[model samples]
Target: MKDVEDNGLKNDAFLAAAASELEQMVEQICERIGTPLHETTELQRQVLAAFGFGAVYSITHRDRLTEPQAHALSIRMLIKPFNYSEQQAVDFVDDLIRVASNEEVHPLMNTIIHRGINGHVQFAQEDYEAMGRNIQEILAAVQQ
Candidate 1:
């Protein structure tokens, strides 16, 4: 089997597609928060970006992750991206939800608000190199 990275053309194409999917996911998330991507406030855009990365990271690391789990992970993942402390992450989630509530995005946040973001996210310590290696291996296996 060819090495996933060695197959430069296919790998690059896959990464491009993955990135585009991530961007679309972020756009959808921002819309759900009641703000169009282009119209989002600077802070909202940052939050949405963090949320998008968080969603992708969770999906990559967890098996069969639910939306609520991904939402919870997004809140936890917001800390470093936003330079927030744990409590601040919770506060940020509350603030985001309040703003979204006004825009009817509150319902999406409501179900996960009480889920708690205080727990440790193992994903925080994941090794990206290992993840890349694993994705390559999976791709190579599937292409066989």
Candidate 2:
């Protein structure tokens, strides 16, 4: 019993350290990408958090996400914040879902991380541009 308790404590400590290290890596990536460390937007934070959770969950619960389940989750993540129509989101999700079940498994983590960051940047950039246009249109309509 004592041995089991000690092992559990050790496992908890290891997880804590790993979590800390992952945060540090994310901070470094943000700095390297020229994004302000202290000024992260809520959307950016949420995206990162979601990716982190997804990675951990995918790894730990590998069997739970069947092909359809994984595809659905990806679709939901991709479309929740964007102005994409449901059909458009579904199409994009369908196209991108193959990455999760690719044959190459060893480099999956790196691929996932890269894809997540790229997707976040692409969506956020486009969303910001669209929002600006919408705001401008609203202002012009108001003035007229």
Residues forming the 10-long window of minimal summed lDDT in candidate 2: 131-140
Candidate 2 local lDDT, residue 84? 43
Superposed model 1: Cα runs more than 4 Å off: 1-6, 59-144
TM-score per candidate, in order?
0.37, 0.39
lDDT of 2 by residue, 1-144 (tens): 999999778655644443443354345445544465346555454334334334333432433444544454444434433334679767755433443445254243335444444433433354434333332342233346
54 in model 1: Cα distance from truth in Å? 1.0
C-alpha-based local distance difference test score of model 2 = 0.44
Clashes of 2: 0
> How badly does each model clash, as a count of residue pairs?
0, 0
CA lDDT, every prediction?
A: 0.44, 0.44
Error of 2 at 64 (Å): 14
